[model samples]
Each structure stands twice: as structure tokens, then as C-alpha cells.
Target: MCPRSFTSTSELLSPEPALVEPNAGNSHSLRANRLLQHAIPPPMLPVVDLDPEQVRVLGCLVEKQLTTPQQYPLTLNALVSACNQSSNRDPVVSFSEEAVERAVTGAKARGLARFVHPSHGRSALRYRHELAEVLGLDERQLALLGVLMLRGPQTPGELRSRTERMARLDGLGEVEAELSALAGREEPLVRRLPRSPGQKEDRYAHCLGSAIRHVEDSAPDEVRQRDVPSQSPVPAPSSPAPGAWSEELAELRHEVARLRRDLDELRSQLGA
Candidate 1:
């Protein structure tokens, strides 16, 4: 059966279905539980399983809305830029505006996003995500979720650092607390995967999409690409010496400057 489309904001905000575990050996209670499960259907719920492109679109919307409110409800061009950003994204993509629009359309059908036609002197259509309102998430929760959607699974430390621009996650403890809150929801939004080999902390992935599963399955390939040089058969390069960090840092600074310039131009276009 097809999931029902959310017709309005109120519909999207519908309360979560309550699931009570039946008491062991209570036949009557078990019967009632079975009936309740059938009565409260999953198809009518707001949950939508997004593809990778849709996940990226929704994540970009959530990110821009929180980090750049004046530029909230981003134009298609700006959203494409956000989706293709170099920093704060894993497996950075070069999505065309058509691809982004298609993703946004898919998200809108599932009630995760809304599209606004050109209005009141604005000639370009803008897009926004309804996740915060639909899922009852705060800025902190949405920020973390956005990062998980943009990047693949991440540890609490990674989340804390990456979400700094969108939300202030004070420390690892705070990040974990928020993650726990997300995972504890009736329809869990995030899950902790078993820690990978050589990793001290467990990584968390968003449950709204199957992209993470694909990411998990392709882990070896990702590792190979990062660790192996295409032209050489040498083992993975060892960590750079202390002196080499300066060069990496300088490159990062240059990237940040470029990003800032792009952001400034976008802001101007948005009249922010």
C-alpha cells in the first residue's frame, strides 16, 4: 500500500503512533495489541524513505534554513550550490539544478519539503524542508540530522565539529545526549552502528534514508579510494609529519575563503 501524502502542515504534525508491548502470557492483551497495530497504520505516518539525492536536498534545506535564516527558503541555484559544497559534506557531489529540483519534488510528495512559486517581486522559486515541524525536532536535533544526511555515519566528535555552524553542540556529552534522544523516539530517527575496527567510538546514521546502508556496503571501496593511490601499489600513506600540517591547514584556509566568497554572493542575490 502506498503511504498517504501529507495534505497540510497540521497533517504532517500528527502525533506519533503509540506502541505498547503486550505483557507476556496475557492472551487477551496480546490480542488487543495485534488489533491496535492493525488499527494504527504505518502508511498514514509522515515517515518517508528518501533516496540519496532526496536526502541531500532535504539536508541542504535544513542546513541553510538554520545557518542562514535570512536566506531561508533557498532558490534553486543556491540550493544546488549548497548540495555541491566542498566542506561539511562527504562524497561531495556535483548536482545540477534539475537534479536538485527533482529531489525537492520527491521530498514534497512525501511531505518533507515545500516549494514556493515566485511571489512578491521574487522571480525564482524557493525550497524549504518541513522536517523540524513534522518531526518535532529542535535546531540541535535537526542540525545533527542534517550532518548525518549530508555526510555518512559519524561519531559524536565529528557531529559536534560539523554541526557547529548550524547549531551549538557544546561537547561530546551534549552531542551524545541529543543523539540518544533521537534514537529513543517512537520512530527512531538515528541508530548507532557497531563500532568499526580501529575506531573507538560508535558512529550514528540517519534512519530516514537508505543511503547510509549503501555507504556501509561500500565501505571497503571508500577505504580503498582514500588509502590507495591509483598509479602506485604502495600501502596506504602514513600520517603526514607535523611539519606537513601547515600546508594542509593553508589549503583549508584557502577553501574556506572561497566558500565565504560564494556565500557572500548568494546572500547578495537573496537580498539578505
Candidate 2:
């Protein structure tokens, strides 16, 4: 559906049903959207069945909400920017405005998005995701989902690192535990993908739908935290070792001690 481009933010917020007046130059076919206004939202759609575009649109909304709440409920133009961003996305895309709007419409039909009227005196309409509410997901799950949907499959180690700014999955173990919890759900939100060719670690793909097309990795499949926009697997031998962790902590402690000594010397100089 190309989202019969029309203006009807009022329909979404109005208390009572009203005839949807299509925009000038549009047709009555757009009137059907009125049903979505008063309609009991459709049942939660399975993330696995969503099309790649739908997944991307929904994920962008969730990501923006979590990462930049001040800019939540993104306008169509802003949303288009997010969908086309090069970073933090797998096999980056440049979806056209029409394509993104259509995807947003598909997501709304699935009860995963909402249309919001212009706010703060802004004239253009804005939209928001109902992803968390529809999926009944908590903050942690939402964070993971947003990343998975935006970036495609990832390993537990990757998930833990990338989600640092969003959730509290302390380490690989916690990431695994949380993944298990999500997988255990009645409609599993995630699944372990069969190991990619030569991949030492099995990656986890989200149920929000598979990538539009399989994207083969160019780099040798090493199970470790990568510099990519998404997931991090436990590092291989070349990756930092556990002892390195202690050494880093030790360095931090030494820095603190140095600062303390410096403070004491300054205090002595001041005759305190």
C-alpha cells in the first residue's frame, strides 16, 4: 500500500468517528483510513512476518525514541533521514520518501506505529512507534530489538557492547540470558541463525524479519567485537584478553592514586 497520502491526524485523536475528508486532489479511497482511527488496534503482529522495509521503519522509530527522546515522534522528513542513514544499519539503503512512507503505513496497519498531529506549532504531521507497547517489551528487550531490527543479526557479545548506551546487559553472559528470555517467549523475538559460512560463532537474528537479501561479510569470520554499527561477538585470541581487563582497571586505579597525590601536594602548598 502506498499510504494513500492524505491528512488526518485529527481522525487519529478525535474522540468520535468523523468522515475522513481527503486532501485536495486526492480521492475517497483515502477515506478508508478513518477506520484506523476508532478501530481497536489490530492484534500484535509477529515480527518475523514483517517485510524488511516495515522492520526498518519501525526500528528507526524505536531507535530514535530510545537514543534521542527529545526528537521522538519524527516527522516524515526526519524519518526518511533515519531510514537512509549509512551507519548503524546493515547493507545500508537509500529508501525513497514514498518507499519509507509506505513502509510506515504498513507498520501502522500492523499496530506498530501511530500518527501524531503536528506539535509545538509545527504544521507538518509526525509519527511514532508503538513497538514496545505492541510487543509488550521492557526497556532492555526494546533496546535489543531496536538494534536487531535496525542492524540485522548479531552475536551475544556484539549485542552487549553495542547496547551499552541503551540497556544494561552487563556482559556476554547477561546478553545470552536475555536472548534466552526473548527466545523463550510464546512468539520468539529472536533466533540463533545457522553459523554463517566459516563463522566461528553463531549469530542471533531477530524475529523482526530477515534482511531483504543475504549480505555476505567480506572479512574473515572471527568471533569478536567488530567496529561495525551492530552486534559484538566474544573477541578471538587477537581480541583483548581477560587479563587485559584487570590491567586496564589497574591503570585506572593508578591514575586515581596519581590524582590524589597531586591533590595532596596542592593542598600542602596552600598550607592546608
Q: What is the lDDT of residue 251 in candidate 1?
A: 96
Model 2 spans with C-alpha error above 4 angstroms: 1-48, 210-272
| Candidate 1 off by > 4 Å | 1-45, 213-272
For 1-272, candidate 1 gives per-residue lDDT tens digits of 23343434456556556666778788888888778768964442345578889999999998888889998899999999999999888879999988998999988866788888889888988998988866778889999999999888999999998999899888999999999999887667898876665789989999887556434666656766766667856698799998899999999999999999999999999999
RMSD of each: 26.3, 22.8
Give a tens-digit lDDT track for model 2, residues 1-272.
11222123333333433556678767564756556554744333253457888888888888888788988889999999999999889859899999999999877766668889876788988999876765667788888988888888888777877888777877788788778888887667887765665567768778765443233343234423343357578766777789999999999999999999999999999999
Note the residue pairs that clash in candidate 1. none
Q: Against the true structure, what is each candidate's TM-score?
A: 0.63, 0.60
- C-alpha lDDT values of all predictions: 0.83, 0.74
Top candidate when judged by lDDT against the true structure: 1
**How close to the true structure is residue 108 of candidate 1, measured as C-alpha lDDT?**
80
